[model samples]
Structures are given as structure tokens and as C-alpha cells.
Target: MALPTFTQRYEAGDAWLANSCAHPTLVQDVWAADMLAPIPSGEEWLVAEARLATGYPKLVRIRAEQRGPVLADPVMDALWWLVPLGAAEELADVRQLVVQAAGWCLNCPPTGWQVEGRMWITRPDGSGLLTDPAVLAAAFGPGGYRLATEASR
Candidate 1:
């Protein structure tokens, strides 16, 4: 299926941002990569962003389940927002939103990725911090932003 327009996707709300606290450093790094150029014809690009405990962004591309044409390498599959080509202007706005959402998520405490139905914060050495119910509650309780589920989409 063709991806939704940038405005539609943005208006649909950020499921990843609503569910997890992305690391600020990582967000900055993704923004810094300046990968928002025009996508070549017949070439599809996937951009994924995550928040890490470490104050640095790691841009390693990994294998991901096929969604579109398999690009050279896939980035993180969880807690990631995909930006397609021809959305340069929207891309800038989305980056800012992601950064802001990461800030909000960070404020909630114990920031991390929500994967496999669990919330996990990562440590510098690639270890996951034990899940804290309190943190989870604060981040995803009543009045919290509800991430858009696939069914809803």
C-alpha cells in the first residue's frame, strides 16, 4: 500500500512518541544526519529514530521485516517513525516533533523503548533496565497520549 501523505500521517499522531521516551541525543543525531533530501525515483527510504539512555545517537542500520522495498539496511523497527521521499518539509517538522516528544517522555522518568508488549530502558552497555511499573504508569496512564494501533490506522 502507498504510504499516507505527510500531513495525514502527522495528523494521525505519533504512535511511537506516544508510547515511549526517545533519547534526546539520538534524536539530535538523526536530525543532524540531514537525510531529508529528495528520494531518487524507484528508490524508497526508511528513516527510524529511537531514544537511548546514552546521550549519543547510534545510527546503525539493521535488518527489518519487509514493508517496502528492502533498502540497503533497515534501522530499528520498534518505536520508529518512517519518513518517505518527497516529504522534505514535513520531515523537518516531524524531526522537531520527535525531539519535543522525546523531551516529554524523558520528563516522565525511566525513558525507554516499548517492545514486545514490555517497556525497557537501555543502559550504556546494551543492557536493559528493569521495568518500573511506576514509571510505566506515569508515562502511559490516564490522559496519556494513546499510540495509534495498526488496526486503528
Candidate 2:
């Protein structure tokens, strides 16, 4: 299948996130300024955070799922993936993955947008897509085949 272009992804992300929050206008405004806006996790989805060192490889190994949304903060050396609601616990065992469920907020930017060292490495495609925690863990699990292959690359 053909992937969505940046414009498509941007529209999808903007529309989806605008509706996800209580104040749509505020979210829009924040994004217009190229600033990170806080998005609450739990009710809709959870966030799986990992160090750039670990998360980048896993994301590369997975080839970036159509529904998988990922964000990166260069300044923080952190990468975040949006996972299904209640799936945070599933990725808890992955050494560097931090599962942020209810009561946690993720700072996010518009799809295809970067601001203050934060960028959307992968944006939400607006197809109700989310990373599968099980798959993420398996791909990054110790001694996994992908690691050996990726290491040699």
C-alpha cells in the first residue's frame, strides 16, 4: 500500500489530536507555535517511552507500522510510542521502556512537526493505529535475531 504523504499525515494528526483534547482551539494554537502540548494518556492510549539508544533500533526493526505513532525528544534522549489503551503494562518488562498509563501526560507536537528538540519521528496516521506492545518487546528482546542483524549493519 502507498503510504500517506507528509501532508496527509499532518492533516490526520492535526484532526485527531484536535479532537482528543478538551480544548481543541488550545491544542491548535500550541501546535501553530511549534510548541509541545501535553496530551493525557490512558483513556485513549498509553505511552511507551524508551531511551533513544534502545527505542530507535526497535522502531527501525519494525519498519514503522502504519498505525504506530512515535515521538522523539532529542534533548531528553527519549523516544515515545503510542500504544493501545491499557497496553502499557505489556511493555513494562522491556529493559528501557517506560510505560506511562493513566495520570501521565505526554508532550506532543503536530504530525510532521518539530519543536524545541522534539519531533514526530512517526506521526499518528489517524487510522486508530497504535503500536502493539508485544511486538515491540519481542523485536527488542535480548538476543533477538533483529539485534544481531542490526548490529552488523
Give the TM-score comparing model 1 with the true structure, all chains together.
0.20
Instruction: List candidate 2 stretches off by more than 4 Å.
Output: 1-5, 145-153
- Per-residue lDDT tens digits for candidate 1, residues 1-153, read 996664454323222322222343443343245322122221222332334321112112211221211111122333432334333333343322131221112211111222223222221111211222222222233332223352265
For model 1, the stretches where C-alpha displacement exceeds 4 angstroms are 1-42, 52-78, 95-153
Best by lDDT: 2
CA shift of 14, model 2, Å = 1.5
Most accurate candidate by TM-score: 2
Give Cα-based local distance difference scores for all models.
0.26, 0.78
lDDT of 2 by residue, 1-153 (tens): 998787987888778866667777888898888788887877677888899876787687775542388889977989988888877667777777888857588888887768888887878777768888777887678754254457789
